[model samples]
Structure formats: C-alpha cells, structure tokens
Target: MLITKGYFYNRESHVNCQALKDAWVTLLSRYHWDWFCTFTFRGEILHPEKASKTFDTLLCKINRALFGR
Candidate 1:
C-alpha cells in the first residue's frame, strides 16, 4: 500500500502531494481550531515541518479509523 499524508493511494496512481497537505491543513483547522489559528497567526512559529508531520499522523489515524487495517 502506498501512503501519502497517511491517506493511502494506489502506487500506480499519480497522487498530488499538495492535495495531502491541503487535507492536513483542513483537518487541523477543523478539529484543532484553537491550535490551528494560534500556530497560523503566531509570528515566528518555526515548526511548520513538525506540524506537517503531526498532520500526517492525524491523517493516518483518521484513515485507519475510517477504513481499518
């Protein structure tokens, strides 16, 4: 199985990474609004990569919950 931002896509399919990033941003904004806004609005919040990883984890968990192993 191929995983992108924790969402699995067929390896043969050309999945856009931007779509996964967008999904991550949406997921954070929707479920973690306070942190999302804080991190977004805060100046010098120098951990975007970390946040991206977190988003990936969240997406993975969500995917597992929705689709199972």
Candidate 2:
C-alpha cells in the first residue's frame, strides 16, 4: 500500500515543519510491518546544501524514532 501526503513550503509560504515530521513518522511506524519501504521527493530544491542538511536531519529523526537509536 502506498500512502501520500502533500505540503508546500518555501520562503513565501508557511508550513508546519513539526507536523510534517510527525506525519512521516506516523506513516512509517504504522507501516513497519512491511518488508521494504521507499520514499521519494519530487520537486526542485533551490538550495541543495540546505536541503541536504535538512534531509539528513529528518533521516536521523526518523531513525531515532523508529529504531530507538
């Protein structure tokens, strides 16, 4: 089963970062029984460096939440 949620965030837009994080955590946890999982982000990232850092941080948060790391 594939679950999808969309949110737009940019310099001109307001988005709840924590809410987005929580949603991803919940989705991943709820589907923990699956043997494999993949996540894809399709959009243009204006700042590659900043986006990379954010992505790394989010991945760490997810890992800690799901694996107790």
lDDT of 1 by residue, 1-69 (tens): 666565557757756677778978887776634432232424555477877886778779989999997
Model 1 poorest ten-residue lDDT run: 32-41
Query: What 10-residue stretch in candidate 2 is worst by lDDT?
Result: 1-10
Off by over 4 Å in 2: 1-46
- What lDDT does the true structure give each of the candidates? 0.68, 0.69
TM-score of candidate 1 versus the correct structure, residues matched by position: 0.35
Per-model TM-score, in order, reads 0.35, 0.34
State the lDDT at 54 in candidate 2. Answer: 73
Provide the lDDT at 21 for model 2: 80
Question: What number of clashing residue pairs does each candidate have, in the order they appear?
Answer: 0, 0
State residue 13's C-alpha deviation in candidate 2, in Å: 36
List candidate 1 segments past 4 Å from native. Answer: 1-46
